[model samples]
Target: MGTFEGLVAFSVTPTRPDESIDEDRLCAHIDTLIAAGVDGIAIFGSTGSIGSFSEAERRRVAEVTTKHVGRRVPVAIGTGAMTTAEAVRLSEHAEKVGADALLVVPITYWPLNEAELCAHYRAIASATQLPIFAYNSPVLTGVDMTPNIIVRLWQDGRVKYLKESARDLLRIPQVKEATEGRLRIFGGRDDSIVEALRLGADGWTSGAANIVPRACRRLFNFANDSQNEFAAHILQRRLAPLMSFLMDKGHVSVCHTALEILGRPIGTPRRPILPLAGEDRIHLEGILRSLEEEL
Candidate 1:
């Protein structure tokens, strides 16, 4: 699996009514993804409700999922915290628990300056031996990283991969050139996967994969093989509607509802992010049914 480049599903973290992680259901979901041929299993990403869970719950997820996965596919912990100290602590825990890599998003309340940003990354990199994924979702994190800051982190060896979640596809080549082709870029935005891969994205870190994994895998396979301009039919037609519809709405909520509709319910999303219902639930079921037919 050298140079393995494909979909790394940003899996949801299922929780009990008390908000504790349902480790049994969680591992089952990971097994489903591995069975579907996903390239990696990334937990605690935005889809995992990264900010809502306590550090202890995250550790349980990291420990249980990594041990359960047993290196079947790579396991990456999104050790994103609001402060450097907390982030570093989580990074140390992830490495200690046998995680393969770290997705270090700048989980900031306020925007960070370039100097502060570089320093934050430097501190995390120094604290862990695992490869870092520069998770850049400016919309949620509120700190859009410039190429120079990203490149500087790469230069310092703090970041080996980037999840460019910026909706703009131009950042693909921009960072590719800035890093001199040394970094691996994974398209993080759901609606942009096909174009992102076409524009030289190394892989995809998708929330939608939690529902329609084989469909996502097919898109990756088609794009990677090139096949003289063969296109991603499943995504362009079946998948894009759901992904795009969820952009302004709840991704985690949609995923949770989709799971229930698919009959592999992983419980509800944590408190405050209510379950998808009524017309929204009906629409998701329709989407899942159509997508399942393709799968």
Candidate 2:
């Protein structure tokens, strides 16, 4: 169930109006992703608003998603939390629920040091047999996983893969060199997929794929499978507007708007993160329509 590679979409957890997880909508959304041919389905990611959920809600989402997916595709569950103990608990619960892999980010307000980061990972690794995908999103997690540290985690056999999201293309090659090809790197942002692959990323962990799965898969195949540089570049260009908005606007909000525009309403985003509105919404729709035609 480990050693996974390819386009893995960070799914947006569909909720009811009251912000409770809508299991029926969530399951249906996953079914669409599997049918669209994503290599894996990741639940409780930033796109899924993992941190916004309570511990109980997170566990429930993991169980329901794993059961509904039913081994159709690899399911990577995000088990990051504010504290080491919470992270371990989430990781253990994820393992107990039959998840194929776990995405762990150093999700704490207090910045973590090199030793603390390693220890946090080691603790979670001890709790689960699932492959660990260390998520390096300094923007969100406040901890940049440097090459040396990433290598150390791999050396300890605690981290099996990396989701590099620093948005610096150079980090791709840096990670490749640091890990000596032992760690498989996945691009975390959609806009950077082509360059990431060109620089040796194994695959992409894209949130945009939730709305445009076919295009994401095509872009990956063109770059990695077909090795068609020209086609890959062209497809990435077509997806750039949506990617740009996602980067400019919040990924979750922009994606939610796109999904609703496409006739798949998953209710409003959880409180404190209102749905997109007005001019930004109009502009996002324009981009979405242009993208739809290209697809």
Candidate 3:
């Protein structure tokens, strides 16, 4: 399909008070992002808590999101699973439901070597024709798919893009160099967007975009505009506090909490991943308020 670029908001699978996937809330949330002019939307990602949902629920989310999005912008479904069989199944489902791309992360109960990782991607890619955006999230997945490994995967023509979330800016150019500018690299952390742009990243994938889509888009536009470096720097400085808060606390929980305070209220995160509370929530409110003044 088409290449994915620009500000792609990493969605939170909005839940009801009972922790069920609230389809109405999810659709409304995506509509908000689309109205804000996001380039794309990624569901069932780490920020969306893909691991928290069952396979059936993931598929339902994919179906609802693709149905709701309806060619407005590309939809990238996270189809990563603990095993190749599950990943293939999810990837096939994503393709069948009209998803534009697949974001596959290496999920392992134990460590995976380079060969095993390669095999994992190869098998999944064979199962679906949708472009694959390999995810490099070592924190949750415990497998840091390196730039070289990613380059190899890209060479095989399966992986078209990479969502690098390791907080290592070096990987941005490293992946580019390894692949000889073949792989589209996206910044994974909100706080790292500026640096990523400076290093020639194609776009950014952010959980915080759920709360501040307009601001995030403006910042990315400024950064990407080349001649507007001065303006981008000013905007980045103004947005730093909120970005810092998101990176410091936790993007998932903070966005969930911030959404509620803004009155959009996507509902609480699922159990075992509690919503932000107490002083942290208060601090987030203050940061968000100040961010509005910057915009």
- Among these predictions, the greatest lDDT belongs to 3
By lDDT, the better pick of 2 and 3 is 3
lDDT-best of 1 and 2: 2
- TM-score per model over all chains: 0.95, 0.97, 0.97
Per-residue lDDT of model 2, residues 41-148, tens digit only: 898888898778999999999999999988888888999999989999999999998998899988988888999999999999998888899999988778898888
Off by over 4 Å in 2: 225-227
Model 3 lowest lDDT segment of ten? 286-295
Q: Which stretches of candidate 3 lie over 4 Å from their true place?
A: none
lDDT of 3 by residue, 94-150 (tens): 999999999998888999999999999999999989999999988777888887788
Backbone atom clashes (below 3 Å) for every candidate: 0, 0, 0
- Residue 1's C-alpha lDDT in candidate 3? 57
lDDT of 1 by residue, 1-295 (tens): 1232589999999877787789999989999998998999899999988988988888888999889988788888999899999899999999999988888899877879999999998999999888898899988889988777888899997588899998789989999988888899999988878889888788999998898888788877876775724466545666787788667567889888888888898888888888888888887777777776655
Candidate 1, residue 125: the lDDT equals: 91
Q: Native-vs-model 3 lDDT?
A: 0.88
How does residue 14 of candidate 2 score in lDDT?
90
lDDT for every model? 0.85, 0.87, 0.88
